[model samples]
Target: MSELLQLIKQAAMEQVESSKPVAVMIGKVVSAAPLEIQLDQKLRLTEEFLVLTKAVVDYSINMTVDHTTESHTHSHSYQDDSTSRTTQPHTHNHAYVGTKSFTIHNKLKVDDHVILLRVQGGQEYIVLDVVGGGIL
Candidate 1:
């Protein structure tokens, strides 16, 4: 009976160890290309082991814009000669219209501290965002 009880306790302990209890952890980026993170002094996770969120990945957004602007200008001039004197005043108004395209880039760099969420079964970690050194 004692032997059976010991076996049941051992099984429960094995199950608990296999299923990691810690769901969230902090990590520091050690590499950018072929990304890698250091979870602890002895545990380093490679790129394949991580799933990156937009906040931690390098990405770009393309945008197009069309708008118009109005402006006004005024000028005054005075001239005098031996026989004549005159003054001229001028005013002008104009509008500027155009269309443009641009891109916004977002990226992450090395040495950034990030938040990580461990996927169920503990096989992968989702990089939520960079918490330190700012997201690039």
Candidate 2:
């Protein structure tokens, strides 16, 4: 029946409108502390609704330096009954142990453009990375 087909179509449309799987959007950071991002003129997301990635957050790492070789050249004078002098080059192998810290990323700032992934159900957005001319 025509009415039955129309009903099915209307129900399908309603279901599509109500279900949100995922969405990608571009947003501009409006505030840093207690971050705020503006998706549009009418929609702005705050920290509570956002999840940040390592690329947009201040991240640090520690590294270790191990065994290494060092070379040095020096002259040694040896005086024998014959009075002779000699110079030699020496190579030294040393075990080096040290910790190095590295900063992988910097936090986002106001006016920065970023890419965001809208999580399913549309309740939260994950900040993937900073884009354009920004700290990224």
Candidate 3:
């Protein structure tokens, strides 16, 4: 009975270890107007990173049968900038070390959302995404 219990515990431990999510770092906000962010280390996204910029709101609005009141709403659109570059696949080595820059051509305001993903390699990290955010 003790041996059987030990086997079960080992299996459970293995399952939990395999289900852990990878570590992700929130990069710094670079060029708020252009919406650029610098990561502390390079990031390799499986797919193209999706960034959404939104405006910050203070309150909201509500209407009643007797009277109406105004509030605040937070919302923004994804604007395309002429300088925006499409997602590309590339590899780099230690030689490419240094602060790398990625520009979000679209005009970004405060409180915008930036989503990044690894669209290509299964578990391998891409060279471009593996840079330090401070370098930018």
Candidate 4:
């Protein structure tokens, strides 16, 4: 019985080793071609067949006053006014600044650089980080 078990284990190991070369070949085939071509060929489809009809939407970074801070942090709010005719009201708030209002005690100064990240939904642009205090 022990000898039979050993033989079975050896056969399993050999099978795994023999498939390594085939796996490597498949990897080479996949990496040799561009992703778009490979997907089209593999799925037997064309780009136009899978084309999306949704309208392309674009976002732009905008700056506004920080009116919700009282100490060291600043805050700003953004609203999308593009689809005002639609039923959905698109608006969001972001507290990028740490204080409730911008004050002289904080690191932020008037005309300082504020980074706004264009995000999808909820808070569109959040304060990533603050820079440029020496200008003031």
Candidate 5:
């Protein structure tokens, strides 16, 4: 019985050693090349790909101020335009300053900026980390 157990353990160890080593791919993830190129196939960029970029955007808010009143002639009420005060209803544009980062769901180029991936098996790879490509 002890010998059989030992044999089983050895077989398990040999199976583990025979398997392919897990590959660690650290670089940009580009799509599979064409037949002419004959490069490894990878994840391709699409029209709805996510990317980061820096941009300056301005925000404005519209506000309404009510400044209308109806005046009626009354003996008790004061009758003078100077005594009554009202503010003009107007809107002023406000400008926002500073640069901000925006997430864009657009197409990406062939080359990648930076990425970390793990090859599960064959041509399959899982993206671990990625950074935006282009000017920041």
Candidate 6:
């Protein structure tokens, strides 16, 4: 009886260990909207990486700004003791960086990753219905 009980416990442990991991991403459906997509708005996505043995998403973001200014002066004198001067104006420029994310149409959970699958008419993306789990 003790051996049978031990075997049952081991089977239960194995079943628990075999369970796959799941990730969920939540967002509204923006593709079917009347208005156009905004500048800083995220795109659409699918349902692939959410369910996996282990989900790993590698991403990075970086931003930088640069500026420069130059000036010069011109002077003229000696026409009946009169003098005239001129100066150049400075130069300035600005740069901007924007990052975009992804969304889905189907059931998007809270902790899932938003991944783009396919573009369906215009810029909208169809969701990926993943039945199985993830590997890498």
lDDT per model vs. reference: 0.75, 0.86, 0.40, 0.33, 0.40, 0.37
Q: What CA RMSD would you report for each candidate?
A: 9.5, 10.6, 23.3, 21.9, 15.9, 16.2
> Can you tell me which runs of candidate 3 are displaced by over 4 Å?
1-22, 41-48, 53-136
Which portions of model 2 show Cα errors greater than 4 Å?
Answer: 1-18, 66-97
Per-candidate TM-score against the hidden true structure:
0.58, 0.62, 0.23, 0.18, 0.27, 0.18
User: Candidate 4: lDDT over CA atoms?
Assistant: 0.33
Tens digits of lDDT, candidate 5, 43-70: 4433233222222112343444444344
Worst 10 residues of 6 by lDDT: 49-58
Candidates 2 and 5: which is better by TM-score? 2
Candidate 5 has a TM-score of: 0.27
- Cα error, residue 105 of model 5, in Å, equals 2.5
Q: Positional deviation of 110 in candidate 6, in angstroms?
A: 1.2
Q: After superposition, how far is residue 106 of candidate 1 from its true place, in Å?
A: 3.3
Task: List, residue by residue over 9-45, the lDDT tens digit for candidate 4.
Answer: 9999877655543110000012211211122234322
Best by TM-score: 2
Show the lowest summed lDDT stretch of 10 residues, model 2. Answer: 87-96
Error of 2 at 92 (Å): 16
In model 5, where do residues sit more than 4 Å from their true spots? 1-18, 29-89, 92-107, 132-136
Clashes of 5: 0
Please estimate how well model 1 matches the true structure, expressed as its whole-model Cα lDDT. Answer: 0.75
Better of 1 and 5 by lDDT: 1
